[model samples]
Target: MVSSGGAAGTSATAAGAAAAAAHSYKQLKEEFVSNLSGGSVTEIAQVCAVAPVVSLLWSVLQARQSFFEPYTPLAFIVDFLLNVGALLLSVTLYSNAPLLLNLLLLTVATFIYLIPADPSIRRKKAKLPPNASSKPSPAGSSPPLGVLSTKPFLTNYRGNMLVVTCICILAVDFRLFPRRFAKVETWGTSLMDMGVGSFVYSAGIVASRPLLKEKAEGKTSPLSTRLVRSFRHSIPLLVLGVVRLLSVKGLDYAEHVTEYGVHWNFFFTLGFLPPFVALFQSALKLVPSYAALAVLLSVGYQVLLEYTELKAFILVGARDNLVSMNREGIFSFLGYLAIFLAGQDAGMFVLPRALPSRFGLSKRYTMLANMAAWTLGWWGLYFLVTNYRVGFGLSVSRRLANLPYVLWVVAFNSGLLFAFALADVVLFPGFYGATDARVEKDMYETATSKVLKAYNRNGLAVFLLANLLTGLVNMTVPTLHVGAVTTVGILGLYMVTLTGVAVGLDVYNVTIKL
Candidate 1:
């Protein structure tokens, strides 16, 4: 018979061992993500290029489906595997995927799929609407022109951004996810580095829809009204921030404190940026001048970082106070607002009505041309700002959310947009938005577009779900010890599960706003 004293001692020892193991596991993760330089701009760009390649592939297959006798399940499986599945692999197992080679191969595959003269595959080519070739319809006419209409390429852009961001957040835990693509300790670029910024940019594309409409109508909401609306809209994110903070702390989750700070998390950053942007716009009355606001904020923030001791304070300051403890989140608020505004600027120009009929180019070509120009211009500025002699002479730092970093986000995203638009021209020959209309009404909706539209419609909901599942996954699985094959399997299952939920929501016409 054991004595009560011995039993108490045994319990105490086991508790200590468990505590030590938990600490070690957390320490291991902190080290895994810490003090690392990021990958090359070229590599980052290459990795991002996969988004457009897969989006184009999906669009093509769906377009072809429009021509052929529909096999709904086969279409879904083939396109999902080829497009989303390939994108998943590109980031994980093939992180070092050769850019030029993949592009060439995919390009060849695109041509082969397109150029082949299969009698069965060919059908009556989809044409513009009967009235499409006529002068633009009057505003009040039947089937009126959708002045605020969005493009599929843009929808594809936002959906792809969400999917890519979600994939990286969880996949980075596994051995299969390349360390070079992980978020850097202080400075540089990576696939993971692009996640938050791209997601913010994606969200911003639609968030400014109301503001854009108001601007077009020459209507303005009072500052107080704007504040209330912005805050009300942001409640979900704010609540999510609180929930995440509580969960991470209460559950003793493995958190790299330096990523956000002692108390701050990304949800907080996302929650607060909009209201501040609203405040700025209300004070300055710069409605629809998003590019100007973005430039002003980024450049002003960079000045503080470069000229003042603010940079050191954020980078190496003591975390003794609330402000210091969450400086990264607090300080980066403006930079992210800048990125969001840049996206808003992109959003305004993306509408078909934003392009002039006198440009001598169709809507697709006009948007593509503008996107290419914007992308090239932003890249030019990125290089310029990065070179000390030519410009600001600062490297990209997501932690700091500096000027070059903002420029990089815009450049990469816009470049991706250009790629998507180009794909529309190649695979979808008619006006960018018209092809999608024809596809749905004339025949069946391809499962690929359905999936993308589902994601686009409920991005925040999907993001929340991804976060929850990521935490659940971490607790359930030994992510660190998992082999490449196991990691891939887990990721495939995880992604399919997410897509399924998203599709399920769409099927029921149930949208998760909060």
Candidate 2:
């Protein structure tokens, strides 16, 4: 009887342990969700409020008489304080507020900042010398800034910085610090998702610029030639992917596919899809309507994927090493291709054949109106699909690249571009005005401009460098054991180093074109 009693006690103990384990798992999952959602909210607020304001300040500084002009100590001090204030407002206030309230406040602030106080401000021109020539320069003489300028829209620098920043933030979020910051899941559309989408879209715009021009001039190459060129461009990416896969073992296969694990996504997509897009351009000669086609393709692809359950098929054996053919890595290429096509379409519209010599008051208002209209239209589409469409929501599944995800990316990108453009118009009146040739030349030569150009010139290199640094830092440090302050300091130092490298490369006129 005593032995029977002991066995019953043992069984009861085992049951209790199992119940405790389940509870712990549930708690962790809930915490993870909360943190990620909060982080995403804060990130959106920062991009909307902080990033544009900072860009405005930079534009104002760049508009000064010269890049090297001497300034009073007080001026420097004031600038420093302003930056600090901007940072605090971006991080603290938005983070503390309710998500709806935060978004509303940001919208109101953005609108106020975009509105011109005096209508005449738009007509103000850069004063020229009496003897200066007034002849208009030939169109297309100036070098294109490659669709990634701070003054115009979501620049490459901003995107690159975001990637690096997210890497650092993730390091902290993943138990590196004492307290957790907001964290998102591998599957969901988070701030990181937006950042990646933006970066990819920017790349697409840059790649398609030359092609768009060629189509416009009726100089598109034959299909065979385009295919060969694309394959040649893809070779390097293939090699890099192979090398990275061989070198970086024991990495989480899930993370690898989810977070750029040495796969040939960027390289292969650029190499392969452009040829197809070019072929479409050549065959149809439909430059104006390509965007509509792209939207149709994105939605259609998502529907097919849902009907077929292709995701389940790919994921079944994903954990095994299958190189590029793995479910997580290969399927995303289609969605990415759609994004690229969309970006190409956007580029055609945003980068017009001719920029006006002078943006008069009425013209400025018209531009603002157009910006607002485009933003609203895209965002409205995003809202409609996510709200009404079955199985549609703003989940940026990088793996799936679903329809809702594509809409979200396009909408936010358009909105950010409009915000930046408005900021530029308000902050640098002379830039959009009928300015002297020399002044215009000097404007492009400013320190800010030079740095941005340099960073953009070797964008792939910068991305690779950041990845290398992230790996090294993870290897050398006990990331989870570090303090929050220490993590921030390290992140700052790392960013500065990356910026310095880009600037140095620019100084030497070095561009690592692949």
How much lDDT does each candidate structure score?
0.77, 0.54
* Backbone steric clashes in candidate 1, count: 0
Candidate 2 local lDDT, 370-414, one digit each (tens) = 667777987787777765465345455555677766777777777
Best by TM-score: 1
- TM-score of every prediction relative to native: 0.91, 0.71
Worst ten in a row by lDDT for model 2: 124-133
Error of 2 at 96 (Å): 5.9
TM-score of model 2 vs. true structure: 0.71
Tell how far residue 78 is off in model 2, in angstroms. 10
Q: Over the full model, what C-alpha lDDT does candidate 2 score relative to the true structure?
A: 0.54
Candidate 2 segments exceeding 4 Å error: 1-48, 62-126, 129-187, 250-273, 279-288, 314-325, 353-368, 388-396, 434-439, 446-450
lDDT of each residue in 35-149, candidate 1, tens digit only: 8788888888777877777776666555554522364676567656755677787887677774863686488557757764444334344233321342343454436444576
List runs of model 1 lying over 4 Å from the truth: 1-4, 65-71, 104-108, 114-123, 126-131, 134-142, 283-288, 352-354, 431-448
